[model samples]
Target chain A: MTEFIPPGTRFHPLPSPFPMKRGGALVGAHVAFETWGELNAARDNAVLIVTGLSPDAHAAANEGNPEAGWWEPMLGPGKPIDTDRWFVVCVNSLGSCKGSTGPASMNPSTGALYRLDFPDLSVEDGADAAASVVRGLGITRLACLIGNSMGGMTALSLLQRHPGIAHAHINISGAPRALPFSIAIRSLQREAIRLDPNWNHGQYDEVTYPESGMRMARKLGVITYRSALEWDGRFGRVRLESDRPDEEPFGLEFQVESYLEGHARRFVRRFDPNCYLYLSRSMDWFDLGPDGLRQIHVDKVLAIGVHTDILFPLQQQQEIADGLREGGADATFLPLESPQGHDAFLVDIARFGPAVAGFLATL
Target chain B: MTEFIPPGTRFHPLPSPFPMKRGGALVGAHVAFETWGELNAARDNAVLIVTGLSPDAHAAANEGNPEAGWWEPMLGPGKPIDTDRWFVVCVNSLGSCKGSTGPASMNPSTGALYRLDFPDLSVEDGADAAASVVRGLGITRLACLIGNSMGGMTALSLLQRHPGIAHAHINISGAPRALPFSIAIRSLQREAIRLDPNWNHGQYDEVTYPESGMRMARKLGVITYRSALEWDGRFGRVRLESDRPDEEPFGLEFQVESYLEGHARRFVRRFDPNCYLYLSRSMDWFDLGPDGLRQIHVDKVLAIGVHTDILFPLQQQQEIADGLREGGADATFLPLESPQGHDAFLVDIARFGPAVAGFLATL
Candidate 1:
């Protein structure tokens, strides 16, 4: 049976060439994970956590790490994720950092990093690898699968690919399908990265790895993710001294611009550029309408969203619930109010905790 | 005595190197006009039409030319700015094209193209110059000064600088001071031009000017001048394909984008880039309450605004009226319903015309 590891806990690797879904000719995955608490008698006391685009297996609370799994507050001993009562599993999806196989992993064919040679990654590959990790941990069934944003996408894919694994779902701030605006925004990011001369077509041994492109992506992405009111509130036209104050372009500028540009630069330093592209593509192709969701059958679902988000906003969540209802699943729509925008689900844990707790109480 | 010109139009020259306030310099300007009906026996039958940012001498009717001045219907013999009763005179402001002296004009001091060397302009300068032109035309008092956007700003500055001009004021969709958000957005356009390699630090000759920078500036300007709701209504992600399909560098993106960019490029060709910079700055620095609202006296005011404008929005118009009221001026605030956003005054002439006509009747 699956076990749950509490906050500040550690886990050992359950290593395997997990046979990644990219035709097996070019890509394979090494799956690993950790669990919290012991499985109940029915082995249905397990919950899986799908994380943001760059989240990893140390989804546990690590002290002093702000970038730790976005849901740190909800996953503690008696918190909503409730490691004390439920066996919880979190797997780093394919084409990511941490334990799962990714672009940085060695290609058996070339005996080198997959790099640009990494096959086009699909959400299915990540889903397949996640299921492998689940079954490997002896988790035969889940009480619920909770996903936020990109993580929510993987959770939805899980229902289609594995019918009986998860008993229920809670998708927050995500869509059953990718919208065109989302695709267009992603295309711009991809272009930003691809256009950089320093990228050297993704072969650069240097650490730069298209920082400007990543900055552009983050700048544009941040705009989509937040509401216009949020922007005005956060960084209107307040000015500060310029970084290059002595230079010719010396002058004060809007504080919002500096905040956005800084966020982009910071992302490039800690993240692998290839991982962002691969993961973003996974998100772009995540549409349940055509083939993915039509094949999936969930027993019950709870799709939640916040009002201020423009990214995977409330409308998209409604679409997910509607799509699930069309697929003959019992689905519910929950619209939460918060000003934190697309990141509200992660930031507003106090409000979200009750929603998850209430759903779990019903179970 | 100044002679009354005919209703269609008349060309007139304001005295050169006009008088200036202390620490103020004159930007070169020439006056153009169109009148309706006859001048009064005292040579006092005159109202002034303070045209918006991008209009010319032809204020009232799209006569022989398909494109007349922006406020065509609102400014004619019988319209709100009644050319018949009041000897209506409209003059192109200094630092503008359409026959006014700007960067494209040869520098009288150096006998060379001023280009970047054009004296930094301000709202005080525009108003002061307009006053000089009217004074030179032998009209000591204006029956009313009606303006929109920058023209509204010019009216406010005229009230601040030369409070002796006849008191009736019509300021549509503008503010007494530039909001910080306005400053930031306009700065982006300036930077796009200033940073362009071809701009050569604003020294580029007319024939080899930075077309790309101009296009980018215009594109940015279009966003501020209109709303996204209007954009979706008009374009809705519609691509504008040129005859050269599969053109290099993905030529001509969305129709709306292309339309604005094309307009911008052409605008820079005819208009002066330096003038754009100067004019935007002039709008930013407008403030009647540097000391206090009561200190600056402005009486007899009609403040009209559109709901869709994010630039110099209705909220600011309300503030302007509030300021005028506190300063002992008769203030009226009116919100015009139009989908045209900031350019509503110029775009929806039918709706704008009647409101203007009614207001001018009272004036």
Candidate 2:
């Protein structure tokens, strides 16, 4: 499948022979990024926005791309992140297929798709790539670093690996390490993809794309992305008005089932399956031991989470606060009661936006 | 695959041309059951157990069958159900493959496996079949009716459909209707089975089994069956002792993944995939609305659930208690603090056992 790159996404060439964390190197590689607003004369007013899995660098529309981005509600001028005051840079993680060099990219060495031949990707490698992009933009020190979900892991790695990279940090719905429950869920998701005969060891073409496997994986993800409370409130035993297809006896019957089917169908062809596998396994392998947080030297830290998020529970945010506080940073933990679960940071702007804005105002 | 029937399960012939709840009839049909203890001359001391999906009629070892049953710890001579005092009859759910006439059974008219040709099976049908077994044994009324998980739905249907059939009811981790979250989960499970090429419209045999699809479905079930808290407490970030398989890049790396893989492998071939699809869809179709609960006429009722249960959550059990209480029955809702989640009734018997025995003692 083709890589999903948004229009006007800028690329930053990495140093030749860039070393990967798990003993591999990439040559002639580049990271995809998009910027909103301009850096001040000092170049210290820049705020880097690292994203979660599946989001492109197109967080919000800029001069180059007028289309609304994924986090358009919170990233535009005078919005929560406020492009009027802060120059925001959002970079697609290194292993993503969204205009970034990943398994879907042609290997300079072999002139073929990397696929399974791609070296093992880790969250740390993503951190290094983001760091390189920040440096390439002529920013010596970011005013603040914002990371959401998987990017939270990357941010922590950045702070630990490259000290004094940022003055303050905002970790949203992320963990220092992968939890067992989350690992199990992702494991099943990868299993679903691999089990598809169409997957064919990642050699699948557009004609034989692993649509069913990707559908199942995406459905499982959508289920965990929200809380059961939200599901009950929204769809509660609501059956489809139309008759189920006679040929498929167990076809769509409930509204919730139809909702999931719609979601999975839209997603299966949009993202490269190989890139998903690599990024997902990278999370499972992430573990920033207890001491990793204490090594960071940021001035201030804000860890935001929602109570309904089972994927990254509220306690994980509290742990971030506690750990960063132990490192002598003025850390504050804010837990919101959003019913959207792990995806609340993206959808529940009413709850998350103010917290982020207030934290940035302090900086 | 073949039906997984335990030794010494007795069958009671159904009325010829047994009618199904959803527009079809079964010929030469039978309901499978196993008994422990003896029914008195008055038959008033008889107790009946309807089961969740995938359990056999042999709930406990009997004189005819010495093998330990699924609920062995909670049943027997001096166990929680206390067969020594009450003659206990456990019936295999009608649409299940464990010694019951399910999709795996041969059709009398066609002399071939029913498979997808089997009529739509509902929880009500299972209730009717269990009611038939009770009446066939010459028992006018049950001392107490016990239902666990899906069986709880069947037991509710029994009380509403067959008035005065059971004098008391004990619902363990059961819901009045299917929740949207649960329906979505089960729908995905059915989709997984149907998408497998080997399923071949439910014409799979031992040689052409849809093992991968079944494995994925079972793994999904196992993940939802237990709570995230239990997973964290049991295998938090524990890696496998052995190295991951070199051939499979996304193979088992963590202990939780290994646990799910082991669990799914043991379950795939044990139960027929067609039977699984039928039974799973039946639960998605089960919904006894607010008025349905009010229609039930029983003397005493007890609904038990655990706080950690996400599949059939604690509020659902409370709903059962509240609804039944409104129906003029003496009902008690007991929520236990078991970290085992939905499967707590099966594994955390220390808490579930006393509740069942206490309810039965009053009966």
Candidate 3:
């Protein structure tokens, strides 16, 4: 299983066994993953982790940072997704530039960045691609397939669409199908990117990406990721008069604007425009098996809901558990409380770690 | 009394006791006013009611649309200022256009409007102008001088700089000195107007008013005037989508935007641009009496504070009362609850009117 991989070692790229095609998009995987511990002989000791969107395969921690992956606190040596026990492998999803086949990678067909012509893709393709990695890596079974947010939807797809895959699924703060509000918000983000003049119909090959468009998208996304109360409490009426100290015009507004701008700027640099759109659209279009969950074939499931997660509220988690139960799968549910809103799944480690650790401990 | 001028009745030439000034850039006025009530022959039965910013000489529900000086509910027959009880004179303070001298009036020095060239008007100047009108109208004494918000500050200025010209003073939600937060907010509003491309340094004439800039200014003002909770409760995530039904596009968000737009549109039509800028600046620079109540001047003070007045909290009202008491004046304090906030004097007429009536009855 994946536990055979060294603990301190990170990037674990599993090349595809064969080529993959979806719609007009042809892709071959060079799946980069971050594995914890060693893969057992039967692979039953293995748990597969997947990141949502934008982040790289480094799902555990950076060499120096030691705390990244949006959910680093929940995955560590003694914590949940315990590196000391279960072999965990988190591979960057397909159609992402984080050491995976993506728009930024040269299209084998045109020998250029895929850009808009990369052809539309869905979450099913992402799940299939991930499954291919497990098979190519010689893992016949996964102990648990873990995913959060968009990644959670992919996990569900993997269990139902790909048979004899993972034995158990852990969905943390996600939905079987995208909420209408989520769809609308994502649509707006895409529109904002499309409206940027520099986007050039996704054609400008001068290497100057549509940073403005990306920044706007990030700003729009961050708004939903944060709570209004948090914004009011943190930056209510603060006017940083001398912020741009060197700049002549000292009239600055609330520091919150600067904070938001920072998030927008940073996100634009490390993320690909097309990948974000594709992932968001994938999340938007996601739904369950043929007839609700009865059609899906997962052996067991553990759904983790968070109270303050407006994006994937408690109802979404409950629906997942209910659907799995209806499908004759052993399902459990856990709810966590955190004011960090949707980001709470990534930040509420004190409660989430215990819940994750206890759940995995049983396995 | 203004009551003599019935509703729908327009005063010819608007009684410009304070001539309109057109100093090169704009034309504005210093309007005059009078009320219709029994003078009691002694003239001591007269009370001069004053307004803060933007209001003209018209105070009563005059014979016009019954909505004139923004304090119509408190000035009608048998109301607080009680047109039936006392002779009331509320003049359009100087540096205002409703028959008062301001940037919109023709400059005596030049043939054009004073416009940007209009000297930075002080609240003290506005108060002195009102005092001039009281003297011009041959009123020997005022039974009481009632002011609200900036009007309250203006009243305080009148009582402080001017001697015992008025016997009783009623200041509602007023501050003798402006708060730093208030100043900062006002500064931002002014900056928005000044930054407008069409503003031309505040010299746009030919009826091509800086409507857009003025709208933004009013929008900023409205945001600050009402509590944000009210915004979320009322507008929240409601959108004014494109006219086409079944349009999947996500359009304008937050009902507050539409709310602000509606308000700004109305204000842009009714109010002058320079007047708003000048009034805001005047408020920013406002200060009355000495450092504390120990140096203020007033005989008897009735200070009213509205609970929802976030801009000028209830404590500011308390400060007004305390200052009067320190100045050896008899002081009375009362709090009125209204969701209308700083604009409660205009909106919560039922509650506000009765409170004013009760206070006036005692006075």
Candidate 4:
């Protein structure tokens, strides 16, 4: 059993000897979370925000850090996930490098960085840890749970593994299982990092991180996250940094190429390679259909899908709602029309905002 | 001007001091080409076959090497491109490593490998060389010109540059210009190769080729060549090598992963990395729309496109047919239904054979 006791704005250690899903266990696992608004005495207005593969607990701006959150558009005072009416708690997922217990964390037993020695993690473990954090905060139940991408998987896993934790759940652009196309994409990404000579088989030091491989991997990721239609409209055959006019005819001529490389270079600094491997694998291994949604205890479920999403296509989201409905649950399937594709939840705020806000309003 | 005096099954030298499109010139550049069947006395039944990236001059079996061709299903004595009625010649493109004058070819000026010193190549150059080969063979008029993917671009360039060489042209899944989406994909692929430490700035020896990066790039290419729907129906979520599989719960669990890796491994042996960079760049540089098809002198044009092709969509094919028709040439647009996507022309033989055969019969 895990227990979380939190003070201040940082992380809180989980109860000693936390067990993992696949074999092995973590002794001193800790979770980092950020809260918005005040928890009512009744503690029924608290909202839990689960994150995707790359984001941390910084879901919104608060007193500690005035910087806007990754989901700033949806988390402000009068936004879809309005902070004014609900207490929001966002946890930095387990097995991530952003202030969470992961490969970068020190092992309590060996006093060394866990690195590859870190135990394998699943969405179940992440849901359990987040639940522990919720319990540690003295909130017995949550008003709603919102998740996107990998977070969507975690939210569903949470409802399946520990029933009655959240009254309603919102899942966006996620899957019941990783499809073959997605698995192939992720496998290539991991190969990019593993093949980097400097990676030293995931043991590279700070001075010798596989920046080249990681950057390329990110470039590939950025391509898959968005749709070809989105790119055609945004960067259609336009040249970048062409003011000099005497540019070489051979390299980086298109604006989209420059955009991908620039974004990837920036990403290499903030993200950890080992954490990427761990989290990506966990997502691929995630499968909740086998357990069936009949056992889910949530009061309401809202599943949103983007028509252009190639990774977790609309069919997967429809499957989620269909399965839920077939199991006698109140499920609403919202199909979104947007060019943003898999990243629609993050980029096409105008479409996602009202849908989420209206649903939360009914609750 | 280029001159082809062929004595063997391999290559015919281009006219010495060949001029390039953007500037510069090659001293002793040559083209690799293979022919099937006999040339009629009138020498008017010759059909030129253009290829996509990575294919060689071998399009069908002949006396020299009786091995079946890459397009064996569509090439034979009575195939769509019948060897009995029409003499067929397939050219290994310029800037390719398959026995053609490319980055791997020796630079006569320096007696060293051209490597990065290879003159910037474009589709126009490929067309120019192909036209010379046709002239060298004493074929004053071609019965038909068949091309696919990059080959399609080359065939159109040939028509635009030197008209009246081919009476009819068939382009399959090729674009008039490289779209931003395709350019971005190609750019990332080049980055993967360039970032490999073993690449050594494209100067690595045979023993130190950047196999890992090339394999990853090929995997990415494979993903784009076919559709997600195709993978779903084919590999689904099947595990890789599952008999007594002590597989770590994380890496390469799907069968598609192993399929991609296997194909990539085999590809690395037959293809050169420098050639990939050169040819990919050449494709990006190809743009025939700016020059206009008003100058095209072909008698008939048939453009085929796959509905699911993300790289070169059906709309692009429609644009091609529209432009040709507007320019006073007889053009027909044929849309195919196949999950094979951009690669449908190569894989969906049943659909392609009838259409191509019917077109050839009409000619």
Top candidate (TM-score): 2
lDDT of 3 by residue, A34-110 (tens): 66677776667888887677666677674523545655777767767787788778878877767666666676767
Best by DockQ: 2
What would the per-residue lDDT of candidate 4 be over residues A1-363, giving only the tens digit for each residue?
011112234787887788999978889789889988888889999999889998888877887777777888999788899888999999989988887798777888899888788988798889888889989999888999888899988988888887789988898997888888888888888888887777776788779989888988898889889988898889877776663242533457778888897899888867888888899888878888665666677888899999988889899999888777776668999999999889999879999999999999989
Worst 10 residues of 1 chain B by lDDT: B1-10
RMSD of 4: 3.7
**lDDT by residue for model 2 (B49-70), tens:** 9888888898888888898888
| TM-score to native of every candidate shown | 0.71, 0.98, 0.56, 0.94
Q: How many residue-pair clashes does candidate 3 contain? A: 46
The superposed Cα distance between candidate 3 and the true structure at residue A128, in angstroms, equals 17
Docking quality tier of model 2:
high
Which TM-score value belongs to model 4?
0.94
Question: In candidate 1, what are the lDDT values of residues B63-134, reduced to their tens digit?
Answer: 423445556666666776676677777766666655556555667788877666666667777777678667
* Every candidate's lDDT: 0.66, 0.91, 0.66, 0.83
> What's the true lDDT of residue A39 in model 2?
95
Native-interface RMSD of candidate 2: 0.8
Off by over 4 Å in 2: A1-3, B1-3
Query: Candidate 2 at residue A1, lDDT?
Result: 32
Question: In angstroms, what RMSD does candidate 2 have relative to the true structure?
Answer: 1.4
lDDT of 1 by residue, A14-114 (tens): 33444445455333446556556677887778888877777666666544232446467888688887877888877777777555566766777888777
